[model samples]
Target: MSMAAPAFNLRTDLDAMWLLPSLKPRIANQLAGLVNTAPAWMKNERPLVSFSFDDVAKSAAHSGARLLAEHGATGTFYVSGSLVGTHSDYWINADRDDIVELIRSGHEIGCHTHGHLSIANATPERIFAETRTNTRFLRTLEPDLKIDNFAYPFGRASPGLKKRLATRFHSSRSTRAEVNHGRIDLQLLSAFPLMDRKMTPRVIDRILDRAVQTNGWAIFYTNDVALQPSPYGCSPALLAYALTAAEARGIECAPIRDALLKIGAERTF
Candidate 1:
């Protein structure tokens, strides 16, 4: 008898994100050392690790917030204004005040465009509307909300796109978390996707040490932390390990927007 073919074959550890204790502690120590030894100009007023959560998933409310809160750290949640009030399963389930509470606590609320998409395929008008319209919606929800921070929808940035958004946004974040040593490109800042499960703490520390040595701003993005986390999320164990390591050192976590703003006022990309 012949067997039927499988309908689908899923991948295992394809993303290569995981949390390793030894590596994380090393990174934590290295970061603290760099902060203590770095030159005055390079050293930010506050030693900051910017934890940013994308898509504003429901898990973020727990995993992201709890870990940061445990260490008295502040994080940034970049929400898509259009997702609000929509009963879409793909979108998170939370109200305006829920978001407001996150802000009211110690976190910062930032914009992630109206719809998360790539600029490579988006038209100029669409880009402006997505960036500008959502900011308006965020403001309408909370009259005093300040739309200072922003990030590219799909980690893709173009010079032309940067020029368009320069006047409207203060700082823009991206997924290129190597280091920010050279001229800081507001439109093309760097970040590491902490939620990628296969990632090792050693790998994370390697990246962190390099970034801290250069006095570069390192922004880590995530959505959840669980053993069977989503494709773009981390496990709770890993999240705790990383946070513990970070805490051992003097590295305090701050929302991405506040981190930049604390360093200095925003500038054009």
Candidate 2:
């Protein structure tokens, strides 16, 4: 049977010019620092790493999943349910079947707001509604799916939104460029990007080495995964390098939910 077309527009508007202004993100970053929702008490014996994809693109659904699987690791894909099967100028977004397959293959599916709206700019009601809508859509694919992890759209979240996200998920990740270590905020867990322009092999190696040295958790985020990737995306080769680096350092690679479990942040799966 053919699936019904999405009730909303399918295009993504992630461009800096289209979303929040430059100064707003800076302000959001500052606000995030002030909020304390869920504090992660770190007791990690070894370094942990999670390779996650936000606003997952189809290439990530395939190549990203494959790369992780090749290394006997899995990833967490933070999906905007409304964008399933959609196409934007920069990405071919993952569809419903891809999400199902991801779960079947042992990848975690985390939540991004349905409209991909920035948590920093949205009202509480809007934030709740969008997240509810996203989970509702995902439930159609896997009725038993438990979305215990979240990512702020555009890596922006207000203080109030941070509190709300903390209450709703086991952990919520932000696009902050650092590793989560001793006494970190679970609500705004730090994640560095794996984009070509932002990270190289040496940078990845350094980060992995640091995580191992500190016995911390490093979460890497990205969008699409292809040989020729989008401007904000990481190439497959870079993704593989990250996985290899983590493995070489004896760092355990897991999805966000599993990593949280390892750190004693228990959630009902």
Best by TM-score: 2
lDDT of 1 by residue, 1-269 (tens): 99998765344342222134344333432332232111122336544567787767666766678777887787888888766544444335445766777767767887788876555456546777887788787787678887777777766655555556676777677776565544555656668888655677887676566655665566778765556777777877666666665555455566767666655644553
lDDT, model 1: 0.65
Deviating ranges (above 4 Å) for candidate 1:
1-47, 85-93
- Summing lDDT over every window of 10 consecutive residues in candidate 2, give the lowest-scoring window: 9-18
- Candidate with top lDDT is 2
For model 2, name the residue pairs that clash. none
Error of 1 at 120 (Å): 3.7
Query: What does the lDDT read for residue 192 in candidate 1?
Result: 82
Off by over 4 Å in 2: 1-25, 266-269
Q: How high is the lDDT of residue 130 in model 1?
A: 87
